[model samples]
Target: MNKPFLRPESGRLCAARAAFSRRAARVVQFGIAAACVALPLAAFAPAAHAERADNDKPLNIEADNMTYDDLKQVNIFTGHVVATKGTIIIKADRVEVTQDPQGYQYATGTSDGGNLSYFRQKRDGLDEYIEGNAVRIDYDGKQDLTTLTTRAVVRRLVGLTTIQDEVHGSVITYDGQKDFYTAKAGPDVAGPGNPTGRVRAMLAPRNGGAAPLTGAPATLTPSTKMQGTQQP
Candidate 1:
């Protein structure tokens, strides 16, 4: 399998078009909604096989307005768009999805309002969860890469309160296949009082006290998902 792209200087993802790993390719084929839901877990843990399978489940979306341009092969969802797959959830003002002729998918989500686009996902077989906020998020299903840009902040938590890891940067990128990530400052510094344009990260030491995630739902079964259709 090809290596996923790192955060490039342009603050945009530039993943090479190549075949994905067996695991990620299956997740990609499951559909865009499911793929987008699984891309935010780099802060929590290296998603195990079970986690990737969870992402292959059905993707549900809610939005005020949506449009699909068949000619251009682009789907756009706007106005309080919320997408969910299994335990993962994403909320933004607008989201755009497009596919390559080869059936690879790309998704971009942006928050037009003051608040950043939000993402949350439960860790595989763990009490911890991952959450993030960014002005925009980009996912490349062909490469199993997710990029967060503009005042990006990602955190890992245990039991909804105890933080396990946190990262702050202008751009943060995660590789789903390898469970690797890179963070850096963007050309334009964003966020409150971040004039120095530096990346800040706080990764909690392993073996820290962690409590079980009470009331968390059990894992859902994976299934062959319908492609490209919007959810009500």
Candidate 2:
């Protein structure tokens, strides 16, 4: 068999092409791995008002002291810690946050001294917010669940001041992803005659027609609008 002689320039060109192909393959593999990690982290992000896209905004934290444990990959914030991401905000004396290998995040907040921990998030498509306070609060980023315990009180506020709805109990659980909550009474309410106690809810009417407690007509005493319309 006769072998054909190859040009040196041709040989060098063939080697360059082979090197380029290998680099391109490695780049493609790296991109695939990056996307896999990104997708899970995006799915596990915490949402405010059932909107996941809004939750993807940057998260900023302020604290007097912070510590991170490499072994557990946990972050601890102490002494007047405040964290905010988009329209969601949390305040606590101490907060511990951990993320699992799967990119799921868990946050726990505890009160120091007599101050209660707080959490607040703006409602979706509405000029309102949901705020709560308790001795301790836990938030699961993966599940979008928030738990408040020990004198837990949650309220829906209108325009930063007016209370549209309220829930009071010893334990309260809220599903931010679903915009729903459950409240239950605990030992603090289980005193004296009220053995099993009760959870209290003060919810406003969606139609704005009746008083929440009395179910009576939502008429203002000495109706200002009526008085203004009357002929002088």
Candidate 3:
């Protein structure tokens, strides 16, 4: 049987949880509470707008092995799968992709063993990027939504380095169209590091007069070579 991610109650665990609560309180004082509403803590800010042309771009994937089902129009890639669509990139141990009749594509990525799947996408017309990690990541092309489940953590980075904001929860649903996201807390995220398993966020103040960072169009390079079996 697999062990739970959460550890048993202990004095050390309680202290860690208390420290986390204090940090969360400090984060709220910084700015999270201003943009977030209570009960699961949803934030609506002027960030996280994904590249507009990403939806039109073709989905490219590389993996060590692949299985394509023509009747179902599904492609499953396993072993170090790296998928790219425009400025968006996802890396996982396994990825299943399916296309709709209208040409839109959907993808689900799963982690490799205990490691979490990774996702990154550049913000439209800005020098910022949105990155996330989770045990499972589901991307809906038609709806322009990315849902991260199980120990989800999402961050907004200024340029390539500076982390402007971040959120943590058991599940996070990011709507690219609306440029917003909602997070839910649950037992899946309950661990020794977070005993309460509550949603936590650190938001940067937007009242500064500084203009949004703008730059030339960003490009993504596939991480690995495409060497896999494909049957049509």
Candidate 4:
């Protein structure tokens, strides 16, 4: 009987091939896990369409008291301030506004004590609106961006009552031009409900229908004229 002979190099080659196969299998498993994690986020990544005409409108502010600094070109409003520009509305205990040389406006709204500042804007040609609450709110007219800082909660509403989607974070930045928003997590938003201070979002299905949301709803109405003193 002929003795079976196996080359030493052949056994080494077989072992190397087995190791590569195991690594490739693990890589495929990791890819599948990553895709599972990304699918839910991608479903809600559609861009919003905000009102384009609001950019051309003027800023109108109402407050209990107003002070204007001519040299600095700034207007400070205090005591229940409400500012409106086209379909956009901002409410806070204090608001500071400044206009640039090119006629673009910037505003910073802050709440007193433990109160939260409010912001709302209508969507373009739709019955929907975007609203948010935070400790501080900033609006940039030139870039059409809104930033909410510290315990921020933003929501998408249908017909001023039904909430379609909601997001919570320590800070949220909304870009009206791009119709998208981003949220960041921080310790400021950590609490009993969210101890880890992670960004949370609740998105509704896009079934071309509005569902009734449970809870008392608030309404926002835009002012046609300025309620505070306008400094030239």
Distance from true position, residue 29, model 3, in Å?
14
lDDT agreement with native, every candidate: 0.65, 0.69, 0.77, 0.79
Candidate 1 residue pairs in backbone clash: none
- Over 4 Å off in model 1, which ranges? 1-50, 100-104, 187-194, 209-232
Q: Whole-model lDDT, candidate 1?
A: 0.65
lDDT minimum window of 10 residues, candidate 1: 218-227
Clashing pairs in 2: none
For candidate 4, which ten residues in a row score worst on lDDT? 219-228
In candidate 4 the C-alpha lDDT for residue 159 amounts to: 86
TM-score to true structure, per model? 0.63, 0.64, 0.70, 0.72
108 in model 2: Cα distance from truth in Å?
A: 1.1
Residue-by-residue lDDT tens digits, candidate 3, 185-213: 78776666445565666655665422232
CA lDDT of 161 in candidate 3?
65
Task: Estimate, for each residue in 1-232, the C-alpha lDDT of model 1 and write its tens digit.
Answer: 9999976444232232333355587775554344322233343464542246434655567899999998888889999998776666778899887878876666788997587998766666777666778999886766766778888877777767876666677788766556666666564444354444545555555767442335342222222342234445
Which segments of model 4 are wrong by more than 4 Å?
1-48, 208-213, 216-232
Cα miss at 61, model 1 (Å)? 1.5
Ranking according to TM-score, highest score first = 4, 3, 2, 1
lDDT value for model 4: 0.79
